[model samples]
Target: MSITSAINLFRQLTVDESQVAHQGQPHVVNETCLDLLLIEMVQVLRTSVAETSFAVPHGGLPPSDSLELPQSSESTTARSNEEQERATELLYYKVERVGFRIGQRLAERYAKDRPRFTDTLDIVKFICKDIWIKLFHKQVDNLKTNHRGVYILQDNKFRWLLRMSGSEGVAHATQQAAPYLWFPCGVIRGILANLGVDSTVSVKETNLPQCAFQIKINRAV
Candidate 1:
């Protein structure tokens, strides 16, 4: 969800001032903790970063040819490693921050309202509409899989992949001159956490066959 929406949800769920010191326990979670968490994020985001994680390294090194020239192959491999190490962090950060804020807001809402639901998948759909669809602007399909490691959203359609997954605090190799968007599985963790579901979502997809930069998600069984 957008930052504004998350903030609205959080504000709606806050406890009243009278409930602050009810009984022996604290009625509301401490603001200091939230401040600390935001501070940590600020520290991590102190510098500017690239817009996309799938960016390729400066090009001059052609595809490696082991048989043609051993010397060139070594340099190509070194360049590849360097590019991999140059993973873009901020693109993933934007995605994860969205998820984190959504989860926090949803959690706060649940705590405050004690809402009830009778419709099947109503709450789930609401979350998908507000949170998932808003950021990516793509249709999200619930996937069926062995062990169900993760919810598979087809990246082929919206063309955003590595942007969604924040691994090692970043999504690398997404902004490279790759053809399509690529999201890693790790990005969904915040959604599940905020949705009050279990953690451990996994994406086992490599690139798609025939299609460019396609990957799927599955839940860990």
Candidate 2:
């Protein structure tokens, strides 16, 4: 099966039946069907590091206005704002853990079909989608390339300005702020390493007033 199919199946089956979107008419696999979809998705990431093309950069991406953060002088005392921020971080961490879990399962499934990008980065996309939806309960629009060096995986439902520019300086930001959900590039690097890519990673943010960014991922020496 294609990686997209595998991911949809995993997400549909792994999630609670009630959580499944009844609006769409995708085939619903029985919960007892612990098939190889989960296995293939994980294995692709394990043995294919140097051969992947996503290791290089691609172009033609879109802007994610949600990625922008709030001003330093502003306030966020609302109970609901606090809650959404918490939910975003909680789900982000969950996705990171689940990606590793998925990768482990995939290594076994692909003991044979291990060739090129077809088996590696494609499955990572699937993993990203599954983890994203399973946690946030919404789809994140995937942006691969645009404006050169920027790609965005946006929260479909949570469309607020997702500014991660000044996350390090948010003195009031406990583990509860949106910046926790709006993770820095370093977090992505660590997540990628845990999945067995074996690469060094670095992150730098724009030092603008409130419009900061933890952009730039450099491979280490």
Candidate 3:
């Protein structure tokens, strides 16, 4: 669906009398604002991890003025590699946590008026239609499942990645954009959790604006 169409739908959805009285009129946010916010959030988290990882001790001299013996190049490279991995892990945890909470609240609000879902597939369809439209302005392009608790949701034009590109080519851009997917993964997980489904959500993005989320439900014996 077009963004304008989605905004119109949102307007209709937000007209609950109680909500209006309690929260006032729902505010419309520019799509670009959310995009920019996500970009800036990732940057800030990365910067925070870098600063924390390399922070100097209060009583110790700065790197340039330190009198401590220098480590070998190999040791330095290994430490750098370790720090980079740690930073990436930390970034994913922080971003996903934020999205998870958002998804939980969104599911609670949107699913309240809907019929009770009958099965795991019913919940997945709800996500593909209602929740996806609410967040991405469109329904999922496709959904596939094996009847054994695994589902794959494909979006041909994922809104978040629509404007992302790099001069370094598609592969490079895809690599850089991978981190952003963590948030949506958390979002899907949160949605499922709130609906009483246990699952894990992962993403695969080999091309621009096209991505697939894999949901693996954990059914009890």
TM-score (all chains, Cα) for each model: 0.35, 0.29, 0.82
Stretches of candidate 2 exceeding 4 Å from the true structure:
1-124, 146-150, 159-176, 182-191, 198-217
lDDT of 1 by residue, 121-202 (tens): 4333444454444343444544323333323433444333322332443224332312122122333454445555555433
Worst 10 residues of 2 by lDDT: 202-211
Cα RMSD, each candidate: 12.5, 18.5, 6.1
Model 1, 208: alpha-carbon shift in Å? 13
Task: Tell me the tens digit of each residue's lDDT in model 2 across 1-221.
Answer: 44455544543443344434764555556633433333333344322321232232122222223447553433444633544455444444443444434444443333224354342244345434543444334454543434333334433333222332335555433222333223323333444444444422222222222222222223346
Best by TM-score: 3
Best to worst by TM-score, what's the order?
3, 1, 2
Error of 2 at 196 (Å): 2.9
Once model 3 is optimally superposed onto the true structure by TM-score, how far is the C-alpha of residue 109 displaced, in angstroms? 0.4
Candidate 3 has an lDDT of 0.78
Overall lDDT per candidate, in order of appearance: 0.40, 0.37, 0.78
Cα deviation at 186, candidate 2, in Å, is 7.7
Please give the distance, in angstroms, between residue 130's alpha carbon in candidate 3 and its true position after superposition.
Answer: 0.3
> Residue pairs in steric clash, candidate 3?
none
